[model samples]
Each structure stands twice: as structure tokens, then as C-alpha cells.
Target: MRLIPTEEQRELAATVRSFVAGRVPMARVREIAGSDEPYDRTAWTRLSSELGLAGLAVPEEHGGSGAGFGEVAAVLEELGAALAPVPYLSVAVAASLLVSLDAKDLLPGVASGEVVAVVARSDGPLPAGRIADRGAWVLEGVVERVPDGPSAGLLLVVASTGEGRRGVFAVEAGAPGLAVMPLTWFDTTRPMARVELGGVPARLLGESDSGAAIDRAADVASVLLAAEQLGGLRRCLDVIVEYAKLRVQFGRFVGSFQAVKHKLADMHCVLEQAESVVRYAVWAADEAPDELPEAAAFAASYLGRAYFQVARDHLLLHGGIGFTWEHDAHLYYKRAKADEVMFGAPRVHRARLAEALGLT
Candidate 1:
């Protein structure tokens, strides 16, 4: 796999970085985080219509740019760095699942960002609902901690339909007996919600064995999420380093101290390692399909913890200011913790990695 990004990829990353910096600056991020709106719809619209980000990975026939996961990774990385409050991850995962299921009808809407789709899967011990059929598929039960659930227009639910069969069903938002309630979360940047399905009617996306598709989509999301984590890791390190260089202690730059230098070096090393793993995961998503499972697990397991560590250390390096709500450091730190548990906790992914390697 190519470790170095191509020129086009680099340009894509640069464009996303510039757009996010200009459009969703930290001030705007803070504003949206506290607002009642699920996210900044205007910015999201621009990301879709102007940047064509929503369709970055979808095929052209599906109204997407047909870009590979590498480009998607670039976009995600910038979004992570800026802590942009959007439903990109949720929508991307849904799109991937729909594509795998050959649900082309939904793809065009998702690609155009006209539809906000999210998957109601497990979020660290949260169980999915069971699917009941009454002439049509019906979903019953509650899905806890659905990322961007309250704002989504479409929901791809993973449900169990007796006889050990698992399926993925597409349910319209606000369907009869479906209630979406936003939850108070630590990471305000990415809001989550609870979805209550009381015999809600849903259309099955594909044939009965949708469990595999959900798992595959999760693997893809894991890789992309790791890329996002890497971006946050790099940004935290940069923030810490910049502060250390500017802040003075005892008439000398704090960064000149041996302890500070050593900490910064370690953070840089970790960031570099995480970047390499994320790059490999992205490449695996595009080229080496056989290696994707293991690579995704490894990236998620390793980068999740690595990014959290960097964010924590960045807070510490900033001294007392980092703990304050006004500081951006805490924001990245909160996102780090959130990302770690979003798909699965680091230990969960590590166990998956072990199972993949036959070490279990």
C-alpha cells in the first residue's frame, strides 16, 4: 500500500482544511455545539453542494464523485481537526452499508447530502432492536446513543429477525411510533440521541443476511474513524507544541525544559505511528480488501487509545487553562474520548484484532 498520498489526495486534504478553517472555525464550532439545532445545516449544505464531500466515496452512477476511501479519509481528517459538528460519519457509514446492500435508491440522496442517514447499531453495550414482520417489517425496541440520530432523515437499523437471522432495514425518520430524543452528552460537538421504535414500519434494505453487511460497514467506518482520530492527535500535538514554544516559565520558554521536550517528542512519535496505521487502513479500504478487516481493527484499536492519550497530554501541557470550557483543548479531549467509544472501545477492537489473528 502507498504510504505517501498522491498529489490529488494532498490537494483534497488542503482544500478541506482551508474550507473547514474558514467556514467552521473554533468559534463557530463552539456556537453550533451549544445551539438547539442538531448541526449547522448551512455548512453541511456547503460541504455537500460546494465541496461535494457527501459524495466523495459514492459511485458516480449513484450521484457521488466515486472517489475512493483515501479521499474520504482526507475529508474526515480535516473535519476531525476542526471538530466540525456534522453528521458526516453517520451518513458515510449508512452510505457504505447501502452500497454494499445494492440499495441504489438511497445512495443518490445520501450522496447529494439531501438525506442525512445514520445507522442504529451498538454503541458499547447498547443492544439493537428485534425485527418483527406483520405483512411488512417492523422494528421494536430502543437504540441508545445513536450518533446524529435526532437530525437524521434516514436510519439504517440493524435488527434481529428470529431463527438467528439478522437484517438491516431502512426506516424513515419520524416514522409512526418512532421517537428520537437528543441526549445530553459530554461531546457536544457530535450530538447523540436515543431512538425508540414501537413497531415502526421499515423496509428491509436487502436480503436476510444483513448482519454481514453491517459488520463490513462497521469495518469501513472503523478505518475512517481512525483517520479522524489521527487528525485530532496531530492537532493536539501541534497545539501543545505551539503553546509550549510561546509560553514562558522562569524567563525561558517552557518548551526548552527537558521534561517538556521529552513529552512533545513522545507525542510526535505516537502521532507519526498513528498516521502510518491510519494510512494503511485507508489504503486497505481501497486496494487490499483482504487485509481490510485486520487493518481496520488494528487501526481502531491502536489509534483510538493513542489519540486519547495525546489529547489528555495536550490538556496537561496547557496547564490549568485546558480544563476550562472556554479553551479548545477540552473540546478535542472530549472528542477523543467520544471517538474511542463511538464504534467500539479500544479493548473491544483489540479483541477483534486478536480474533482476526487467531490469537483468541
Candidate 2:
């Protein structure tokens, strides 16, 4: 499979990069981070209407652009680099799950960016919450650390039914007996919340034993998130490399120092390797479905740690200023840490990779 972007993909990436750079610069990101709102709805609308980013991966029959995951991956990289405070992952990934389950009725709203949905599954081995079917389906229990939960209009909950079957249920954001409590997390760019359901009414989206669809969606999200981390990692490396070239230290450019040069070289090498892994994962998402499981596992496990390390090194290379809250370095550092654990931690994915390879 081609691991590199085509000309059209390159143009798409450049367009998204430029758009994010102009619209959601670091200053704008800081503004959103300090605001009470989780993300800028106006910007999100613009992305949907102007760029059609919300429908990048949805089928044409579903009011989407009919693009593949490669295009989605390209856009995600820019979003990650700019730390654009939008629910692309929450919405797009959820739409993917619904599509996989043949729940096309929900695709129009999601593809139009009118509905923001998040899967209320925790970062655990099993699905969260217990489901009951008393005349109609109802969910009762708590799901913690749901990404963009407070801002979501819909929640795709994974629950175990009375028949001991795992299924996905759609719950309205403001349904009675449902409480969404916002949580303070490390990354302000991506907000999270705790969802507590007390017999909240829900509609079943997929059949029982559709837990595999959730797992597939998580794999898709993991690969896309790794692409985002790669972008942030590249940005950190770029900023540091430029700073080293210009920052004068002890009568010479810091970059001229042998130690600094070696560090920069090592960082570049790692960045290239990480890019290869991310691109391969994205390709698997589009072209090679059978390889996607293992590819996603490897990308999630490797890129998370690789990106975090690069972010840490970038901070160190920037000296004391990087440690300050005012510097962008700290922002990327926090994002790295949060993303490292978002889908699943590196160790968790590594275990999955091992199991997928039949080692466990």
C-alpha cells in the first residue's frame, strides 16, 4: 500500500493546515482553552459548511463528501497541530460506528455537523453501564471520562442488556434522569465529562453482540488520533529546530552545538518513523481492512509513546521557558499526555497488539 499522500491528499492537507493556521492559531486555541465552552461552535460550523470536514469520511448517499479515512486522517493532523477545539473525533468516529452497524438514519445529522455524539465507553476492557428492556430500553449506571460529553447532543452508550448481551444505545443529551457532569482534565483542547444515567430512556442503535462495532470504531479512532499526535509531534520538532537555529548561546547558535545537533537529528529520525507508522495505519483503514486491527494497535501503542517523548524533549530543548504555562510547549506536552491515554494507553494497545498477533 502507498504510505505517502497523493497529490490530491497533499493539497487537502495543505488547505486544512492553512485554514487551521489562519483561523485557530495558538492564540485562538488559548482563548478557547480559557473559555467556559468546550469548543467554538462557530468554527465547527464553518468547518462543516465551508470545508465539509464533518462529512469527510461518510458516504455520499449519507450527505457526506464520500471521502475515505485518508482524507479524514489528513484533516485530523492539522486539527491536532493547531489543537483546534472541535469534536471531529467524537462526531466522525461515532458516525463511522453507526454506519458500520447500518444505522443510516443517524448519519444525516452527524454528517451535517448538526449533531455531536460520543460513545460513552470507558477506557476499560468491557462496556460500561447495564441496560434494561422494560417495554423500552433504559440505561442505568455511570460512564466516566467521556470525551466531549458535556457538549455532545447525543451519546452512543455501550451497555449490557438484561439478556447478557452487549449493545449500543443512543441517548439524547438532555434526557431525564441523565446527568452530564463536566470534568477537569489535563488537555483543555479536548473537554471530557462524566455521564450518569438513572434509567434514562435510550434507543438501541445496533443489535446485541454489536460490541465488536464499538471495538472497530475505537480502532478507527485510535489510528486517527495517532495521526493527530504525529502532527503535534512534528510541530514540536519544527518549533524547537527553528528556535535552536536562532537562539544564541555562549557566542554561537544553540543549533551549532554538537549535543544540540545530535538531539535534533534524533528527534527528526523519530518523527519520520512515527510518520511512517501513522501513514501505514491510515492506509490500512482505507485499503487493507484485514490489516487495520494490528496496524491500529501498533500505531496507537507506538505513536503515543513516541509523540509524548518528542513533546517532552521539545520542552527540555526549549529550556525554562517551556515549563511556563504561557508557553505553547506546555500545551503540547499536556496534549501528548492526554492523548497517550485517550483511546487506550500504550501498554493497553501493546497488549492488544500481542493478542492480535496470537502471542497471548
Candidate 3:
């Protein structure tokens, strides 16, 4: 498998990097972070209509370019670097799940970016009473911490029959008894919500038993989220290194010190290692599906801890300025911290990796 990105993929990354740098810079991100919506509508429109990024990896029949996940991963990295306040990752995860389930009706809307969807990664299946039966498909439960939940027009959940049967379900926006409360989270750039469904009607999107599909979705989410973290990690490395070069200490540049140089080198090594794992995970997503589980687990566990460490060093290396709320360093730190626990901590991922490798 090619761990290195193809030229086309590199171009895609550069294009997205340029677009985000010009349109949704750190200043714009800060503005969105302070708002309740926490996502840039205008930029989302442009990304959908102008760039067609929403459909980059979708099949042509589904109103997409029929590209691969590699392209999508590249775009995600750029978004992570800019800390763009958009629901791309959530949408990507939801759309990909729909695609695999062959939900023909919903894929078109998702690919065209007309239906914004987010996955509710609930820890357990909806209790027997929490979901109705006999073709009713009415759901009742609270899915806390749903990414982009407030902005999603559709919420996809994996619920079990409580008799061992599992299925993928969808709940439309404005459904009766459906409530989405925007959360005041640490990382406002990726806003979340507490979604409550009190007897809300839903539609089953796929087969009667969706255990494998649900597991695949988790692996997909892990790898994609790691992609975003990798981007943030790279940005931390860049900003910290630049600061070291410019800031003077004792009438000498901070970067010129041997100790500071070693620290920077260590961070660089971590960043490169993360990039390797993430790149391979993205490749495995499509080309080598069977290997994705192991790759995703490795990427998630490694990058989560790696990004947090680099982010912490990024802040400390900046001296007093990094700790200030006004500086962007703190924002990356928050993203790193939030991401580290996003999938129940790096140790959880390590355990998953071990299980997938048959070591447990």
C-alpha cells in the first residue's frame, strides 16, 4: 500500500489549505466559536456548491464524483489545520455509513449536501422500551454529545432490538418529540449537542442485523477523527517552531538554544509518525478494507496522545503568550484535549487495537 500521497491528493490538500486560509482563517474560526451555531454557513455553502467537497468521495449515482476516501481524508486534514468550524467530519461519517448500507434515498441528499446528517455514537443500544416495534420505529432516548447534532437535518443511530438484532435508523429534523440542545463544550470549533428523542419516529436504513456495519462506522470515525487531529498537530508544530525562531531570550533567539532545538526535533518526530499512521489508515479505508480496523485503532490511539503532547509543548514553548485566551495556541490545546477523550481516551483505542490484533 502506498503510504505516500499521490500527486493528485497533494494538490487536493493544497487547494483546500489555500481555500481555508483565505476564507475561514483563525479569526473567522474564533468568530464562529463564540457564536451558538459554531459553524460557518457561508463557507459550507461554498464548499458544497463551488468545490463540491461534500460529494468528493461519493459515488456518481449518489450525486458525487465517485472518488475515493483518500481525497476526503486530505480535505479533512486541511480543515483540521485551519480549525475550520464546519460539520464536514460529521457529515462524512454519516454519509459514509449511509453509502455502505445502500440507503439509496438518503445518499443523494447527503452527497449533494442538501441533507446534513450526524451520527449519534451511543454507548449502548436503545432499550427495548426506548424504541417501538411492529414497523413503528419510534425512538425514545437521549444521545448526549452528538457532533454537529444541532445543525444536522438527520440523525443516524444504531439501535438494537434488545433481542440481539441490530439495525441502523434515521430520525429527521423537526420530528415530533425530537430536541437538540447545543452544548457549551470546550472545543467550540466542533460544536456538539444533547439530542433527546421522546417517542420520535424514525426509519430503518439498513439490514436487520447491522453489527458489522456499526463496527465499521466506528473504525471509520476513529481514522477520520485522527486525520483531523493530525492536522491540528501539524499546525501546532508549525506555529511553535516559528515562535521559537522569532522570540528572543537573554538577547538570543529561542530556537537557537540546544534544548529548544531538541524539543522541536522530538515534536517533529511525533508529527511524522502520526502522519504515517493516518495516511495508511486512510488508504486502508477503501483499498484494504479488512486491514482498516487495525490501522484505525493504531492511528486513533497513537495520534490522540501524540497530538496532546505536541499541543502542550506548543503552548509551553510559546512562553506566556500561548497561555493567553487571545492566542490561538490555547485553541489547539483545547482541540487536542477534547480529541484525546473523544473516543474514550487513547488507552481505550489501545485496547481496541489489541483486540483487533487478537492480542487480547
Candidate 1 C-alpha lDDT tens digits along 154-212: 98888877666678888898799889999999999998999888888888889877777
lDDT of 3: 0.87
lDDT per residue for candidate 3 within 1-360, as digits (tens), equals 787888998999999999999999999999989877658999998887788888887889989889888888899999999999889998888888888888888888888787888888776545222435675777767877887888899989766655687677788889998898998888878888888878888887777788788889889899999999999999999998988989999999999999999999999999999999999999999799999999999988999999999999999999998889999989999999998888678898899889988999
Worst 10 residues of 1 by lDDT: 124-133
The residue pairs that clash in candidate 2, if any, are none
lDDT of 2 by residue, 1-360 (tens): 688898888899899888887888889889988899889898899898888888888898998988998999888888888889898878878888888888898988889898887888865433344435556777788888898887799999888765556788899889998999989898888899998888788888778778678778888989989988998999999999999989998999999999999999999999999999999999998999889999999999999998999999999999888899889998999999999998878999999999999999
What local lDDT score does residue 128 receive in model 2, on the 0 to 100 scale?
41
Question: Highest lDDT among the candidates is held by which one?
Answer: 1
Candidate 1 backbone collisions, by pair: none
Model 2 segments beyond 4 Å from truth? 125-134, 162-164
Worst 10-residue lDDT window, candidate 3: 123-132
